[model samples]
Target: MSSYEENYLARRPEYLCHMCGKCCRVVTTSIPYKELKKRSQKGEKGASDFLSLFEPYESIEVARKVDAAVVDNIINRLIDDGNYNEEEITFYCCKYLGDDNLCSRYHTRLTLCRHCPSSPWSIVPPGCGFEGWLFWQREQEKQKVRLLKEELIELELLKHRTSDSQMLDKIDSVQSKIRKNINLYKRYGSENW
Candidate 1:
């Protein structure tokens, strides 16, 4: 087997995705119309057009029939953190997901599809492909944060020796933003953000 296939086999103990595509049929992410227009202009019409194909849910409970536990968990977390609104809790899915579990716009599918529930660290359906990817992504992110922290320490030492207060403040602010973003990713998992 190719190294990639071999690696996947070695790491993934159970690959039970039947590709029934129920998850795809039932769940979706919504983007604002302005953002959709921008993406369409950039040749991402599938995502832009997706906004027109689905209706929004009124509540997390309504969204739950599709995947209530996952949806509730995400919504509750975001709400607790003050990052989400009640109106934004609406769930959606494309109208083009046919009875045969195929997307009419499969070729031009959005980033949501590429990193759907099956993607790493997501609360995908049971037996999805997220478990292995989540572990790998966490390890990679930890390594990245460690490296960035080291760089920030070095920059701090340099800042202490220099009298450029403005430059020092800028560097400190930037580093703080990076650390905050890293922490956000760590806390929420890459998929949720």
Candidate 2:
């Protein structure tokens, strides 16, 4: 099964899309559009993949026409997140989305579109079908962080109690990477979670 399908089975029931197409019609990102464009120009893979499939709406009003609630939800979430600078947040829509809420180039849709809602925390339209899935994913993440915290404590104790410098160095490296991974959720208040 595809990773998305696997996630559906593992967490929520068989996933069912409401077909509002709000996700494809309106999308936003913490990454600014200008920076994405610059990175695409510089041949960055993620940026290039994004710009390849999605283009900016001619203006915010144009995006609003496509799905105002989705657009407004994204903007409001970004504002509330507190980590994002107001000007640095950006939104875009798939040019391939059709009036019937179908993808014009479904077979050839880019990976970014195919694998959208990249995480549980992705801000989607208010009533998207993935809402329950997202909530389950967040709870899964919290459990993971809790486990990592326990592991980190053990690693710290091992490092200090052992005189093997090489082993201690390895332990330190593992701890560092784990902390880095955890911090990705820190913006969601992982520290307090």
Candidate 3:
């Protein structure tokens, strides 16, 4: 195993998620039913149908009350990475979450639902799969970043042998691009990337 993998493995914790369904109802992405249908037709089942059942909070603060830390973490990460604009940062919720706190469409839930709270290092909601999934994702991201950095180093060394300044400049530009991509992935949960 790579050092990164080893480090993550060493830090992995054991926790059983108690499916309180609090996270599901407290905050959701507000996708319109029409758009969801379109996505479903295109085989994007998760995105397409989610907005059909639940209503989004008129304001984000309401959603944050359910789990301020998780909501804040998601919002900050999106803002830092520039993937979400201010309007998109508004609080959202799933349509299918019933009053009983069970997903009405639990059997047909999206991939995200199946792997929710999937982080290893972070503390998760009660009955969340946070530790296992989060650990795996962090390790994967570290591996990807390590590979990109290695490639950048190799390109840098190549520049010393080539008198072509333009070629070197291009390599540098590519390296920067790669680094930015890595940073983007890091800022968001690995699933988003």
Candidate 4:
């Protein structure tokens, strides 16, 4: 991971969690359940770790019944982001969640559970305590991408004003790095920003 990601993770406020258990009650992965199972069997750490604790609901309707707000929030966010696909979506619930909205295996919870809301772009349940924090984090990332894009434009101008092979090569290298940084947020619609 990049230092920026490391810093963001380090700064995440665990205290912000409301412990409402909505997130634990209803969660969805980007891939289908079958693919996730295949990946887990193949020893993919993320998939394996996720399935180690979470089991797929019989259907999305069942998941919504478990926690309608969270399920709806996730679906709405996916739709808004142009990433919704009913065929590939699969909701899962933690097998270890207790009736009191606490983890049955709190002490031994997997890293995936511990890292809930793992990124700024995580689609947390509506009214979640981390909602504001996640939004701010996302804005910070967008701003960083915007700044990098501006830098790329500056570099382009510099290239146009320079004829030296060594200087042009240096400009090209810097532009590549800046573009790579911006590309990191391409999925988040960084181009529109």
RMSD of each: 7.4, 3.8, 7.5, 1.7
Error of 3 at 23 (Å): 3.2
- Which model is ahead, 2 or 4, in terms of TM-score? 4
Q: Give the candidate order by descending lDDT.
A: 4, 2, 3, 1
Better of 1 and 4 by TM-score: 4
Give the candidate order by descending TM-score.
Answer: 4, 2, 1, 3
The superposed Cα distance between candidate 2 and the true structure at residue 183, in angstroms, equals 3.5
- Tens digits of lDDT, candidate 2, 70-189: 877877777687655646655677777888998888888876766667677878788988887788888988999989988999998887789988998899899999999889888788
Global lDDT of each candidate: 0.61, 0.79, 0.63, 0.88
Candidate 1: stretches off by over 4 Å:
1-23, 28-47, 100-105, 108-112, 115-127, 158-193
Q: Put down candidate 4 lDDT per residue, 80-189, tens digits, no spaces.
A: 98889998899988889999999989998887887778889988888889999999988998888888888988899999898999999999998998888788889988
lDDT for predicted candidate 4 compared with the true structure = 0.88
| Candidate with maximal lDDT | 4
Off by over 4 Å in 2: 1-14, 83-86, 151-181
**Preferred candidate (TM-score higher): 2 or 3:** 2
Top candidate when judged by TM-score against the true structure: 4
